[model samples]
Target: MTAPGLFVSFEGIDGSGKSTQARLLAETLRARDRDVVLTREPGGSPGAEEIRALVLQGDPDRWSAQTELLLFTAARRDHLERTIRPALAAGRIVICDRFADSTRMYQGLSRGDLRPAVDQLHDLMIGTEPDLTFLIDMDPGQGLARAKSRATAEERFEDFGLDLQTRMRAGFLALAREFPDRIRVIDGNRAKAAVAADVLAVLEAELS
Candidate 1:
């Protein structure tokens, strides 16, 4: 029987460079002859991608915390069914840019005190968690500046400004503390190459 696959996730506030790091890790692993599926949350499947556009574009107030939670859960369910589960079942490494922890922060703590609802919904509708999660920690001010430089349509969350990013950073750190064994915190206030190196080292240690 094929060995079971590993499910990994990268998470941080906007502009924390988790996305870039995720891509870099996927590419490096592929070079080593590992089958890697690099995907993102609120996306990763066709249906989920559509939902991504809905949640990511538009104004910051486009959806309330409760509504956003439902939308995100729906997207995650579809992503799991159509993309993540199949990849892992086939023994392919699935590296996700963001996962449920993002929901726990963005929709759960950032917008309001909906963490319990987030956890309840997560347990009910989406029961899987990444085998390993990297919480890329950085200064919210710097990260927000970096994020706005891209000026992407997915600026809805970034538009919430530095205050939101600050809260998000704290929330992510708290999450890292909560799941100490599974979540590894990495300092992302360095050069991209440096951050990638730390990420690779951590992952290699895990694989070993």
Candidate 2:
């Protein structure tokens, strides 16, 4: 029988460099002859990609928090069914840019106190969690500045401004505390190479 696959996710506030790290890790693993699938939340599958455009490119207030939660859950369901599950079943490491933890922060805590609802919907529609998660921690001000510099259309969340970023940083930290065993916090204020090295070391330890 094939060994079970590993599910890994990288999460952080906008512009925290989690996306870059995810890509770098995927490249490194592939170089080592490991089968890896690099994917992202809200756009991992065809159906999820459609939902991503609807939720990410609009005005900050285009959808209410409750509405956004439902949309995200739907997207996650499709992503799991079409991308994540299949890869894991095939014994390939799945490295995702974001996962349910993002919904817990963005739709659950950022907009309002709808965490219970997010949890309920998550339990009902999507029930998978990453085996390991890297929470790249950085100052909200710097992170927001970096995010805006990119000027991507997915700036809807970044458009919320520094205050929201601050809150999100705190929320993600608290979440790390909540899931200390599975979530590893990394300081993202350093150079890209430094952060990437640290992440790789931690991941290698886990793999061993």
Candidate 3:
């Protein structure tokens, strides 16, 4: 029988080092001779990348919460169809930097009332969830500092200020609780190597 594909996702607030950790995990798994596909949401596929520019650029309010949700779901659908699903079907390990969880956190915070819309849309259009999700948890202050240091046009989301980041951190923690089976919270305030080590430990436990 063909073995099922492994789908892993890394999630965290801006500057929580999720992207770096995701890359490290991908490299480590590859070193072990595993078929790994390291990708990111909102832009994993060509069409999704185009949507990424639209959603991540411009002013913070460039798109309303509802509109942004639609755009994100669109991108996610494309990414899944063009990149994620294909890799998974081939029995490759797929590691995504961010996934639908991000849309839930961001849009849910933008307008607390939009949380339902986000969840409902996800259920309808994006039925798949990650097999494992690593949430790099950290203080919003520290995370904002890290994010500001590497500011770019994509600052639209990061520009939401410290309060929003703090709230989003809470949102993520709540999500971890809600999906305890799939979400693993990692302390991200440590050194990169240390954090990556913890990430590997957690992932290895799952794999083994």
Candidate 4:
């Protein structure tokens, strides 16, 4: 594997607007002449995207605990090899929409013990570490309400009630505790511009 490059990932529940923030960050980086590559997990590569469809299409609650772990790992393996690795090798700033933490939280929803294994896999596949990982935190109920209003499509995980999402939100907070250096938690209850500004503050401190 190549040496590490500047990598950052945005993580949060379904409706925390991770993608929106990621795009804003990417554009800002580009404006500053930083080579930036924006990608997302469970769907970064072609193979991984197919895995995403499978994982998200079914009732996530019904998917066996082990099945959930394997599917996410499978997608992650492909994503790391195909998308994240190359971009970083080129010295690009990779702003990913979501990464291993998503799996840790979602898998935790099913089986808590799967965390150690996921962490190990994450260490293996994630060749580069984010200088900063903005974790958008939101109340599960509010996020789910927003998610329901925005997405017209159906997915297994999308059908989960607010309770599950709430648990997942807590899981993310716990993850930040586990990796304080890389993870920066952002309150997602605020306005979009406010959230964006908060993220930029961290980036400024890091890049300058």
TM-score of each: 0.98, 0.98, 0.97, 0.90
Residue range 37-147, candidate 3, lDDT tens digits: 999988999999999999988888788888989999999999999998899899999999999889889996644668888889989998889999999998999999899
Q: For all candidates, what are the clash counts?
A: 0, 0, 0, 2
In model 4, the runs with Cα more than 4 Å from the true position are 1-4, 109-112, 123-129
Query: Residue 146 CA error for candidate 3 (Å)?
Result: 0.8
Question: Candidate 3: which stretches are off by over 4 Å?
Answer: 1-3
On lDDT, the leading prediction is: 1
Better of 1 and 2 by lDDT: 1
Off by over 4 Å in 2: 1-3
Per residue, candidate 4 scores C-alpha lDDT tens digits across 54-105 of 7777555667767778888888888888988888888888888888778788
lDDT of 2 by residue, 16-68 (tens): 99999999999999999999999998889999999999999978999999999
Over 85-200, each residue of candidate 1 has an lDDT whose tens digit, in order, gives 99999999999999999999999999999999999999999889999999999999999999999978899999999999999999999999999989999999999999999999
Report every candidate's CA lDDT. Answer: 0.95, 0.94, 0.91, 0.81
- Candidate 2 weakest lDDT stretch, 10 residues: 1-10
Task: Estimate candidate 2's RMSD in Å.
Answer: 1.6
Pairs clashing within candidate 1: none
